[model samples]
Target chain A: MESKVNKYSKQFILFNSIFIFCWLVISIFPFLWTFWGSFKVKADFFSRADWWYTVSGVNTLIETGGRSTLEAYINSWIEGEFWRAARNTAIVTFSVVTISLFLGTLGAYALSRSTYKYAFWILIAALVFRAMPHITLVSGYLFPFFQLKIWGILPTTIIVLVAINQPFTLWLLYSFFKTVPKELDESALIDGASYFQAFRHIIMPVMWPGVITAGLFSLMLAYNDFTVTALLLNQQNYTMVPKINAFLGTVEHGGNYMWAVASVVSATAPLFMIVMFFQRQLISGLTTGAVKG
Target chain B: MPHKTFFWFFFPSGLAMILFIGLPIFSSFFQSLHIETEQILIEVETCDPFGCEMEVQVDQEATGLLREESPLGRFNGFGTYLDRNHLAFDDLGAGWETKTSIRNFISIVLNLPFYKSLLFTLTFCFSVTPVVVCLGFVVALSVNALAKSIKGPVIFGTILPMIVTPLIGSLVLFWMIDAQGILGATLQKILDDPNLSLKASRNLTWITLIIYGIWHNTPFAFVVFYAALQTVPQEPVEAAIIDGASRFQRVRYIVLPHVYPVATFIALICLMDNFRVFEPIIGFSAEGVAQSLSWMIYKDLRNETLMLFGSAGATSMLTILGVAILLTPVLIRTWKEFRTDR
Candidate 1:
């Protein structure tokens, strides 16, 4: 019996080693390749038959004619207009996150704690709404927006994003709010605090976990959105996803690959920071709907 | 709580959904039924100075009447939905009827934009789900067996592919598939074909996109399965081991059953998500080689002069119908669970 256990453990170790080794290589290789390629001159990136040119020969930065990747970043920031796209992304992410959190907290609080059975039905409706492909929603928005002359504007897309994000926000926050004991805040109303005030002073601090998770989801949604913003926003209002796509088209057609890689690298810098710090929250936020709720 | 409290609390999100989701769904349906047009008239201007010009102009009164009839568009109920850009039922029937063989018939059908995109979308959805789920399960098991101290970094690495923005993730990998890029160069050398290019072939493009789909989605499934693994009851595993079961037998009888529900959950979500594959084709600039249902809609709306809202609206309806078909089983199952629980 002991011999069998030992033999199985050895097999398991061997299997796991192979899986992890393969996974790590596939996960890290592309980003490392892109990161390396981003610093190489346009000629090497496009013309050279060898991809090892960056490491083998003197790697020249495509932007600013420098020898370092820093100039590539600067060009992405300035010439590629990623800074503008970043600023637009920040505004959209911040607005969508804050507004979704604020509204989601209120709505979820009511939906979870209310004795009214209709609140449950409202959540089911939100779930259905959430399940629909968002392109359908964008298609719906086009004509009304064009008729109203509100199309191709940042605020228009922001509001649409907030709306698309509502169901997810409410669903995640509802589960989060359910975890908090109702008695904790229900007693505050007996002490003369209104429901809103009870929610404000009593429940707000405890629900931070859910709020943060929902905010992370919101931030990721707004940050990574390509479909709606790509369709709805005009050239002047393009966000990071669409902006990088534009660079991909323009540069790939023009035979300049460096700018596209540089822009992608710059666009993803903030996400790397977010993942490093908030990996736990991001995972929890993503799986909350699946596993818990 | 007062009854009015529900209203006050839910009003904001409720209004947002009404304005955006609820209204748009209704509007999309209505838009699918309508086809907008300009009321045009030819005006021949005769100038006294011996020059005459003829110009086609939009008839303002008639245009206003058209807008008044339906601000979204003129109500051509179901016409756009059946047009050559959409269902094209007659054209499809003719193509199928005229073909000499199955391969010729398929080629004819695939030439239709809507059918071509549907072919790719369904192919992507059906292929990616099972592959990602199985890969995810293996990774989950492997991660679960690792030393506790090393697990954190391993998980972080696993999640990195998923964490990158979808467009950028596809682009980062799309660069490598370039003819001059590393993998492309390696493949060229390994195969001894100097002229081999991923971009130059449709079949290779589809495979690369499928591989990208699996690469991007596996981590999410892995994370979910890993979380589910923590809750797996250990007694059955131990009992099976003591009963002279092999490791494979134990996994088959104990561990597999434990994560079965999560595997199903991930499969359902993956099906729904993969049905809307859009960004990769755009990111790779492979629109010429591949198109998705979502990309098809984007194409219609991005037309140079006319936005083609009517065509986009019809395609959106079809996409919504596709999603509904995918979602029905899950919805029915959930409804059953709710009924039984109550």
Candidate 2:
């Protein structure tokens, strides 16, 4: 029996090792390719592929093309307008997060404790609204403003984004708030603390993680979004994704491969920074709040 | 003490939602019912290399109508349902005409593109969700099963892929599949079949996408399942284990039932996200074969006669119903669990 158990244990270890290797290779290699490609010079990229590391002076010939891999990195930085796109993304993310956080917390508090007959309906309706594709809503959403001749498309977009993001934010915050002991509210009430006071003093601190999680998700969603921005923003007014997409198109059309790599790198910088900074919280929050909600 | 405070708390969200979400939806529904003059038809008098490829541009202004026809071309009271009277055009704008017939909705539902998308979404959701859940479950259960020393790194390693932006994930996949890429070269040799190019083949694209999506999304499921598993009542699991039930059997009877709610929740959100998926399709559509519902809506809006209005609205309604139907069983099961727990 002991020998059989040992054999099973060994087989399990071997199976797991193979699975882990495949999983790691599959998940990590793509990002690595992107990272490496970002450093390749445009001129040598194609040639290097055709005559890769022949080592009969091939490496030197590839290196002498007056183009460095780092050129794409620099070119993408300048040409892709990374700074402006980053600024636009930051503004959108900050505004959406702040507004939704405030509204979601309040709305969630109400839905959590208030025995209103319509609360469930409100939640379900919000979910349905959020579930509808943004592309479906873009024309109708922008039409009213178009008729009124309101040209501030960016601000209008932010408002729409906040509205769409609220459903998930509110749902997540409500769930978190519900997890807090209700006696906290009861005690605060006994002490003459109003609902607002109870929320601010008692529940807020407990639910801070949930609020942050929702905020991060909102930020990520806004930052990573491509379709709506592509449809709404003009060519001259490129967001991060549209800019990356343009470079991608250029590469597909056999334009500068170097520029494409650079664009991808610059576009992903904020994402990388956010992930590195908030890796743990982001993962946990993603599952609990975003997925589970 | 009074109801006013509750109103204040609830009213803003409700009102804002009504104005922003509800209002647009209803107005779009209304707009679908009107005759649109914005439809532009262009007639090209050309002597082509093959023959004269004459293109006729229909001007909506000629009809003096706000829309080409009432939505669905028929009149239903207040446009609450599909109308058949509004479709007056035989073929308004060359091969792309104002389809003001029941065929529009029927085609939207039954056509190859819609079915392709539906199949893609179903296979996608099913393929990805289980892999994610299983991967997540393994990571979560193993971590919980492991000694404290081995848990941390495994958890972090498993979660590393989930933090990157989803769009970035696709871009990264694109680069990896380039001809000279490390795996690309290896795959070129191993998957020598010409059909295996992840960039070109729709089936390959779907598989690659599901794999990438599962890799990115599993960590999320893992974390929730992990956290929920931690909260699962230990006594029942221990009792089952003590009954000489194997680990798999114990998990089947004890751990699975406990984790079912979280799994259902993840599955629900995943279904919605997958159904509305546009980015991966857009990213992967270099060959233009991957036309999803969201992409179709985008395409329809660009048509000159605005042929998309009825179909898009109908599609959205159908999609909502699909979601409701898909989630009903899970919803019922969840409600039962919650009630029993209470």
Q: Top model by TM-score, which number? A: 1
State each model's TM-score restricted to chain B: 0.90, 0.70
Q: Cα lDDT of all candidates, in order?
A: 0.83, 0.63
DockQ of 2: 0.36
Model 2 Cα displacement at A182 (Å)?
Answer: 3.6
Which portions of model 2 show Cα errors greater than 4 Å? A1-18, A42-68, A185-194, A197-207, A251-257, A283-293, B34-112, B143-150, B191-200, B233-246, B302-311, B333-342
TM-score of 1: 0.92
Residue runs of model 1 more than 4 Å from their true location after superposition: A1-8, A57-69, A190-192, A252-256, B38-73
Q: Is the docking of candidate 1 incorrect, acceptable, medium or high quality?
A: medium
- Estimate the lDDT of model 1: 0.83
Give the Å error, residue B144, model 1: 0.7
Index of the highest-DockQ prediction: 1
